[model samples]
Target: MNYALFIARKIYNGGDNTQKVSKPAINIATIGVAIGLAVMIISVCVVLGFKHSIRDKIVGFGSHITVANFLTLQSSEQYPIVINDSLTKELKTIPGVKHIQRYAYTQGILKTNSDFLGVVLKGVGPDFDSTFIHNNMVEGVIPRFSDTENQQNIVISKTIADKLKLKVGQRLFAYFINKQNVRTRKFTIAGIYSTNMKQFDAQVCFTDLYTAKKLNGWEADQYSGAEILVNDFLQLDPISYDVLSKVKNKVDHYGETYSSENIIEQNPQIFSWLDLMDMNVWIILALMIAVAGVTMISGLLIIILERTQMIGILKALGSRNKQIRHIFLWFATFIIGRGLIIGNIIGFGIIFLQKWTGLIKLDPQTYYVSTVPVEINISLIVALNLATLLICVLVLIAPSYLISHIHPAKSMHYE
Candidate 1:
């Protein structure tokens, strides 16, 4: 008979005594392992969700790299916002340069009869990339500047619409200062959109480049500034640095500061809050694993003690010490492996249920995009399983040591 198989079979049935003291501890061990595996899988999926979601949203609004002049929107004086065809061609050749755009923005008020809404008005030239924004738009078009040529067509947001009781083709008065520094004419609301972002949905509006220039009384060729988009977002810092090398005197508007005065730099509280939560998740995982390891260790120890006679019997029958160790290890391995499989299935099922049904709810204002997002990284799952299996198998070493100490004559007669 294969001792490993026989020992495993014995252990599986050994915990059947209902009133036995050892049975409770063995039960706790299984529960601990199940809980640990579940927690690890869920934690990994959630964190991965957060990292990917935030990164996509940010990089969507602002490209990987941004370039601008020292003075911004209202303060900047006498500049060329347009990327001359020559500069555009040269910039396109730069590595990681996916698309380049010239964009201008101004803060203005939208008056609808009795109500007035303060909004940041953005204008983009024909070369502007709308792919990202267009795909994310929940309603309305990106506004075609081709036919009207700045003829009072603007896109407003849903929040602004609700506040102002405005809609497409309804004229909403937008007032701003012209280049001549005089109060400008009001623009007409031609279309409306919602980007699913509260901050932008409520306070931002858009039109084409010619429209902003016409309202500002500037030359047909002028603009406020340009926005550069990159191929990949990971190289954001490096690309920002390289572009700034050419325009050393220029200040970036989108994500402009390398200084402590910058909003992100000054108010680190947001990122700190996320990092703290991340730490908590990690700590929770570590504690769960420790709980599992301790409980499993206890169970193994109990098995080793109860089977002292059997280990000695196997040895007296000319069995190798290593074989005696394997006898118990086979049992432990089967137990842990079964728990791992079941735990993963249960955890993944819960995640899928929550994802499909949205059984879990969160405040949209706090979580940004609403609903809990989940991301599954297959590689991460594989790595976690491998680590757990290795660590648990190594831990069996301590329990297996019991075999060498079991002398045949002494253990067989002791009981």
Candidate 2:
């Protein structure tokens, strides 16, 4: 009963070979669609993967949110704040708050006989979640920290290690200037990790909280700040606001006011750079879609012209212009559908290959990742396919009008 689709199928199946000229245009159009879609898919996946990887790396160094003293926020100095059990309990009550742990910082210098490096000794208590550091460890295991004892074990980054020619299990003396009094402590490196983030890797080293507290001359129950982890990063702002409400204007035992800031606020430069990648992806997508649509339109016009005799015969047999238009539209759909299938195969093949084998590599120093990252979002892929198909078909509608303008008598004579 659907004569348009029936005719479209017969023509698509090469029922008529007289339109040999159109074959080349059709193939070019399909190739154009396939390549454009593949490029779009690859662009989206790469950008998203880059964003996710970089965000995690930053968050791993500093948690989702930081609650520190107002003075500490102003200056990176470890101004003491008291995080008692009661305060911890109150913060844990806030929705989306996953974990809370005490942290402190002391700027010091690591010295060996061969080289010396400036570093920040980040002190974490027994409650510190070592998952992030553990995952990135290259040389040794993350040492266990205890609140009762000053464990002189520390974790250093590979960048610092390579720079200073230091290794895990090596004894290094760290010197800190406290109130113009130079103090020294000997620590054994327990682990070496690399996140490929030069900012953190070159400067930050992890040590037990007690050791950092002693270095800062702080008493028990005193810390520089608390790092808050949230269940979902999307809820970070709301959770940070909730935390600020609990601690804002409230003084610790030392009379220090608490200030809360999310990871994005702490590192604006890096996040802003990451945000720019989205713009790049949008531009790529727009250009690729335009290229594909143009090709499809051209191919549709050629196919309509080549089938002029068929159009005339159908019109003479009492077929309407609308019905004839549907015939070519259906034919265009078939071509577009075939291109989509090929594009999806090619796109996903590259994505999976890179993801599994890391066949393509990037400079860690610049990209913050060793290999090209790709994230396959099924929903996004499906949406892209649907949108591409719809847009190409819609663009071909005007060209399909050429079929309507073909006079039956004239088209019958169209060679």
Candidate 3:
């Protein structure tokens, strides 16, 4: 906008407010806009932060991708799992690949004291990623590879341990149904770990790969599918595609094309629920931006109304209409930009505070965590900034158009 026109617009918008709208009204309007913007921005950041944080937890516990046996049975019976270890070794060379471990998990019953619970007994080799539960261990130790024959040791979840009143070095009997559907063998309690997700922690128990092999009666070379731990969880889609190129000689589950997914796909419903939350966050974000933009538009219109007479004088004094629009544009945009900055400050401040202090609480029984998790998506914030700014500019078109219709002759001669 032209500098002179902009100044003219501002003066006209102000309209000698001293004699018209009292300073109190202007203050209220400014404060109202500030509050609305702050609320919207903060709401968006908080909700999105929670969604992203939960996803990272899921990824850290499980990898970005897994290669497991396809569900071929329709009778609701467990299927036999086997993977091509040669193909797994070849797939590990793909870029962004980190580590691959063969795993076999089966539903088993563990008996400890007065309690009996079902758990996913994971049979893993020495190469398993210990970091997943390294920090999450709240009691006992992690599942150590048994060094002796007939070791019969296992790691249980904290939830299970508490319910059963069992501790480390206690004997826990595990019952596994073989391919023949016969109960065979028992595992001892060597360690206990918790991921804090009761849904997961309560059900996941761990043991060595050799034990799973003995139970399944598979040959030395046969085992269940592989869990592919990646350098980054976000690389799942791209790496999964590359995986198809390498694992063609092996089993193909998706239309004869090996797309990544494993026996661990049992938790699809939980993940689907998580994805729903992601969509909810985005929808809330869109609504917030709209609410903030709408409130600012109302403020600008109020400012425009109070300046009608000044707009007339400027128009009569030979100032072009386009220049007149700039003054109001600058005023409204400046206010919005200021509010945006303030909102971001408060939003991120709250996130850090909650992260350190855990001031916000949620019911772990219902929410899976004791406090809200905050994970800022920088790209999301940037997109929100641009989007809100653009909406403000576009909505400004309405009241600003009122500039062209201002009749200076009648205004200077009349009120």
RMSD of 1: 4.9
In model 2, what are the clashing residue pairs, if there are any?
Answer: none
TM-score of each: 0.80, 0.96, 0.83
Please give, for residues 1-415, the per-residue lDDT of candidate 3 as tens digits.
Answer: 5685457444536654444543443454445445555555566666666665555556556566766444522223334445665677787888888888777666777776677877777777777787767766776777566312345778787788888888887776777775597665666677777656766777887788778776766655555567776676567668877875565445543332233553225457666776687687667666666666676677777766767777788787887887778777876676667667766777677777887898989887776667887666678767766777778768887878877887987665543
lDDT of each residue in 303-391, candidate 1, tens digit only: 77877776677788898888878877777776677667877887798778866887777675667656777788789877877777667
What's the residue-level lDDT of 397 in candidate 1?
Answer: 84
> What is residue 401's positional error in candidate 2, in angstroms?
1.6
Best by lDDT: 2
Q: List ranges where model 3 is wrong by over 4 Å.
A: 1-29, 71-85, 146-152, 177-190, 232-235, 248-266, 413-415
lDDT of model 1 at position 158: 79
lDDT of 3 at 400: 86
Residue pairs with backbone atoms closer than 3 Å in model 1 (clashes): 68-251, 69-251, 70-251, 179-216
Sorted by TM-score (best first), the order is: 2, 3, 1
* Shift of residue 246 alpha carbon in model 3, Å: 3.9
Higher-TM-score candidate of 1 and 2: 2
